[model samples]
Target: MSLTAGILAGAAGTTALNIAGYLDMTVRGRPASVLPARAAGELAERAGADLGSGETADSRREGLGALLGYATGLAVGGLYGLLAGDRRLPPPVAALGLSAMAMAASVTPLTALRLTDPRDWSASSWVSDIVPHLAYGLTAATVYDRLTRL
Candidate 1:
């Protein structure tokens, strides 16, 4: 798979995932997850940059969290693009795989840094994480397949 196609497909897929995630949040009356923002804060601290205190940090944290999410999608999409033509897994299954890969990308680092734990998540929390990823995977896989013609 071409890097260009992967990037394009990943962006499209990530957009779809965000739409799904926001919709779920609206429907459930849930606040956005803070784990990513906190993770971003940790990364910033490690880089010797203060996110500042109070509102500024909150705002930047939120924005940076989203950018990181987008970057995750791009990375996964690039991987998917590289694997696009493999016939061992059909598009539907490949979508599931892609979604899990993205989820792992988010979950692993957060957990490793002691910022979050999936083990502590509730069922709804699980749903919150899974749905958007499913949306991402399905959307990305379909787009990747279609665009790359694999």
Candidate 2:
């Protein structure tokens, strides 16, 4: 698939996943409050420090990682869709894709620090993160399918 098409598809998929996550939380009667945008902005600023020292090179690496990550997600999700009779397995594909992304992140060597702290993440945080990744995977797959017969 074309790069632009893939990105557009991925964005749509991410949005859908976000909506699904909010709905899931609501259905479970959990607090559906989003982290304050200001707080998120502040956290991003703090996270920026972790990205120390390789600004230009890191940007290129990140771009590559994102592209590779999307492709990996698409393959996994597409395979899941094909193999599993139930449609729900695509979520599992997404999970696998996300795990692969972590591996990709580890090997990419773009930044000085690993972006996410697994130890610091609660189960809820993990689920939240994975669900969106899965959405991205599925989106990538859908886009790829539309763009390429493969």
Candidate 3:
């Protein structure tokens, strides 16, 4: 039950994150990031899996990247459920913790692949990165709390 609730919460949170990102793009007129696809391609190459050439490869990478993001969100949510069980943390703590965990999970791989370095990000870049995660955290925490309240 907890796991199910967490996963549903995660789905909601992921949706919120995506909406926030799209809104940011609309407001700022910035292009979408290709880092996710690049990360997927790099990992696939490292694992000795060929994704093919030309447009097909690009499409595959994009699809894989999206799937990877979903997987990360769901896995994180499942972990949260397992950890929290029937207990509820304070709202702020849950939000911060979940946001930090998701951010770390997403960023660590890119950093490891030398794809990005958050330490050198500009203020605006940091803001762009963080705001969406905060949305995810807040939504996920709220949903989880509501669903688990008995």
Task: Give the TM-scores of the predictions, in the order they appear.
Answer: 0.92, 0.46, 0.96
Residue range 68-144, candidate 2, lDDT tens digits: 44454444434434443233334455445534553343323322334444667789866765665565556655654
Clashing pairs in 3: none
Question: What is the Å distance of residue 70 in model 2 from its true position?
Answer: 15
- TM-score, prediction 2: 0.46
Task: Name the candidate that leads on TM-score.
Answer: 3
For all candidates in order, the CA lDDT equals 0.86, 0.48, 0.90
lDDT of 3 at 52: 95
Candidate 3 lDDT over 1-150, as tens digits, reads 989988988888888888998999999999988989999999999999999999999999999999988888887788888898898799999999889888888899999999999989999988888999999899999999999996
Candidate achieving the largest lDDT: 3
lDDT of model 2 at position 89: 30
